[model samples]
Target: MTEGDGNGFDTMSRRPPSRSIIEAVAEAEGVPAHELRPPTYESLHTVIDPDALDALFEPHADGTVRPAGRVTFPYCGYTVTVDADGSVSLE
Candidate 1:
């Protein structure tokens, strides 16, 4: 689990098991998943560059994406974080 603020964010036991970070965040936030849109990690230009995010988090051959890092930023008044295993946390 990730170590984050206690106000609202909490570490997930495992990967969110969703197709997209947006969907994962929506589910965690208790809002409709459609409200968030992410074509790739790059879709969030306000937090990080699209191309750079893709390069950093894109899946590898055989459809396996396991990064050695994580990304955290704010979105729609929530603190959004993405982990190496595609897990997502919302605060």
Candidate 2:
């Protein structure tokens, strides 16, 4: 488990991560939430397609989402990783 410092940042730590994938990444970057685009933003076009990310992580017809392995990519000066347990890592 990653321990959040007083400011809610846990460098290279494995915290619960934010509900919104973009939130987690943005939080890690210390960037203003408003200026950043969510992971689902179409222009980004990450290794994990925005829609696929939503479909894999977001609620489905069963109202539940399950782990579907992991994927990592570089973005905005950080190495963003989406994990199987639904945690985002920035290192």
Candidate 3:
């Protein structure tokens, strides 16, 4: 539900993790999300499948939340970590 800049980065509440990642990185880079494109940065898809990433943390078919978990990967310059609770950290 929150996002941070500088040395610490955090969560996104309503948006999907994929979109949150873009926003978080854009904020960190001091650019608009649209500016996070070719010639400056690689597309997020080139690094990770956005749709799959979203699905990984979605609530289960039965409406139960998944167990606590996190996914980490390298994108842009920072390592992105997305938690089951929807918190995203960039480091």
Candidate 4:
């Protein structure tokens, strides 16, 4: 695992998440969860918005609506789809 010390970038000596984290990500993505596949670590770091990605993890904090991993921002109606491989494909 890599750790950032409040800087642009840094490295850490921690291990990555287990298979369960993948399952949790899948569940958060609203898919079969178990069927969801893990994405490459590099891909995971490519997210443009960290907060937006976190929103995908635990969308609801205190029972309030939150943005999905995939989203159509500034639009009234639309749907977002987050693939198992951590790919965001829109329709």
C-alpha positional error of residue 35 in candidate 4 after TM-score superposition, expressed in Å: 16
- Clash pairs (backbone) in predicted model 3: none
Model 1, residue pairs in steric clash? 42-50
List residue ranges in candidate 3 displaced over 4 A. 1-7
TM, every model: 0.52, 0.53, 0.87, 0.22
For model 3, residues 1-91, the per-residue Cα lDDT tens digits are 2333545587667578999999988988889998999988999999999999999999999988778989999999888999988888898
How would you encode candidate 1's per-residue C-alpha lDDT over 1-91 as one tens digit per residue? 3224654444444333233555655666566766565542234556656466556666777777675778877765567766776556666
Collision count for each candidate, in order: 1, 0, 0, 1
Each prediction's RMSD over C-alphas, in Å, is 6.2, 7.0, 3.2, 16.0
TM-score of 2: 0.53
What lDDT does candidate 2 reach at residue 20?
A: 49
Candidate that would win on lDDT: 3
lDDT of 2 by residue, 27-90 (tens): 6656755656655342345444676664555545776656466666666555566665566665
lDDT of 3 at 76: 92
Top candidate, metric TM-score: 3
Q: Which ten residues in a row have the lowest lDDT in candidate 3?
A: 1-10
List per-prediction Cα lDDT, in the order shown. Answer: 0.57, 0.52, 0.87, 0.34
Ranking by TM-score: 3, 2, 1, 4
